[model samples]
Target: MKRTSLIIVSVLVLLSIALTACQPASTKVRVATDATFPPFETVDEATKELTGFDVELMNALAAKAGIEIEWVNIGFDPMLAGLSQCQYDVAIAAITITEDRKKDMLFSEPYINAGQIISVQKSNTEITGPESLAGKKVGAQLGTTGAIEAQKIEGVELKTYDSYDLAFLDLANGQIDAVIADYPTALGFIGQNSEKLTTVGEVFTDESYGIAVCNKNADLLKKINDGLAAIKADGTVQKLEMKWLAGQ
Candidate 1:
């Protein structure tokens, strides 16, 4: 009887090990985003739902990668910090890839090409671009590449805001001379306030936007890159550009 019991116990242990080994890893990911930038990511005022190019693109990629996602809308700076600390699985905004940032977090392959541009009041002629912003008040969203560029302008008074909308508002109200922001994002703002705002000069810095992943989440990065490659090859990215950026 003792020998028979030992054999049964050994069989159950082996079976348990096999079952555990056969189980698939969890693919549900927590995706963080800052939903304030338009054309890239924004919240719909009427529905209070997140919408924009990044949102749609992320959904497509998640579906292609066979992963489930839960959206977490957070401040852009906080999102970056959280990603570096491995607090979130992934983050997708119009986040420009940089070597300095690369030290903290992992990034997917370049998904979109973006650049910083200068936006000023439509009637303003004195301020032409970053060069002309010298000795002038310039506004940008806090913790963005735009703000970094603004800070580079010698003699320029740099003011950082929580969102581009507020910076543009300050520009419209004559509180600030100009705003530095991503070209497509600036276009979205200018399109809505055509009478009040317009971009000057040209895109200043060449930038590539990438999906941010936590340093510890290498598998997630691979999934994102695979999905991104598929979408780019299938014309999905071009379709999104037309849908959101062409008119703006």
Candidate 2:
């Protein structure tokens, strides 16, 4: 009886090991982001860990695709450069999908469609739209589509900041006339600071946020896209959107 029990246990253990071996190994994927962008990705004040929509979504996608991830928080400009230079496997900030970026790297299916908007002091009445940005000082994060759009505003003095937190600081201090940023991001930033800031003007341009992969890494891109599709179909994306963008 004891010998039979031992043989049965041994068979079970071997079967467990075989099943585990049959499953795909977890792929370690390194993801880069600028955590200053709230709602999309931010460093939680108390925990000091990256947490937000993009962070959560990236984690979900990685788990679904049997991938382990290392999150790297860095400056927005360098994040893109690093992705292209192969320093990271993915860039998952609220990076806008643009023709210019497509030239350098492949973008995953757009996870969110957002638009550029203007933010101004709550008391300000002078600026009404993008046209009003002309001849005024405006701020945007460096290397963002918003910053690029600001540069084309005739006679506008564009102030570039590494992070939007500093841009909002300058805005509060009346350093810049207004700030141009993504609609959802501006909404998130002003949600708790409504007394100080407000969004103005219609969405200035149609934009989409996507995960950036090295153009050369098609296999990795496919994994991300497949995972994203699964999540979207299973309502994961909708749940996240509702949680993060409820009032916006």
Candidate 3:
């Protein structure tokens, strides 16, 4: 009996080693984002760590996909450039999906719907929407859909900023006449400075936000889409919306 027990223990140990050897190494994906956009992605002032809707959603997706991630907070345009070069495994920064962008990188299924809107000083009534912006100074974040929309309006003096917060600041200081930005992002700014700014007119352009992956990383793309689908089906997306954008 003792000899039989010893043989069984040896077999079990070898089987455990074989199983461990068969398992693949964990995948660690590098993710990029511009943390300046709030409610979607932002750095916590108190903890100095990244926080917000996109950050939380990505964390959930990473867990679901069984991958480790390294977050890279970078400028919006730089992030795009890096993503195109396959320098990062994934990016999620409230990036809007467009045909032009689709040419350069792979995009996961859109996760959020955000449209462009015009914002002006509280006392200003002259500017109503895109039509009223002719010959006016309009600010938009560089390399964003808002910038593209602002450029479509002929005769407008377009001022591009690295981030929307700066553009909104300039608007508040009377340096710019209007700011064209994603509706929820504009709402994030307006929520903080409600006394100084308000959005005018309806959302002019319909846009959807998506997670970006380099064309070479189809496997990662699948994981992201799969995780996104899971989150959507499990009500995680709705819960995030309620947490970050409920009253905005």
**What local lDDT score does residue 174 receive in model 2, on the 0 to 100 scale?**
92
User: Whole-model Cα lDDT per candidate?
Assistant: 0.91, 0.91, 0.94
Q: For model 1, which pairs clash?
A: none
lDDT, residue 136, candidate 2: 92
lDDT score of residue 193 within candidate 3:
91
- Provide the lDDT at 86 for model 3: 93
Which parts of model 3 have CA positions greater than 4 angstroms off?
1-18
Estimate, for each residue in 61-125, the C-alpha lDDT of model 1 and write its tens digit: 88888889999999999999998998898999899999999999999999889999999998899
Q: Candidate 2's residue-wise lDDT over 1-248, tens digit each?
A: 99999999999999999999999876898899999988888989899999999999999988888779999999999999988888899999899999989988999999999999999998899999988888899999999988999998898999999998898888888999899998888888888678899988799898999999988899999999999998998999999999998785
- Among all windows of 10 consecutive residues in model 1, the one with the lowest summed lDDT is 127-136
Estimate the TM-score for candidate 1: 0.91
Q: Runs in model 1 with CA error above 4 Å?
A: 1-21
Clashing pairs in 3: none
**lDDT, residue 118, model 1:** 94
Task: Give the lDDT of residue 107 in candidate 2.
Answer: 94
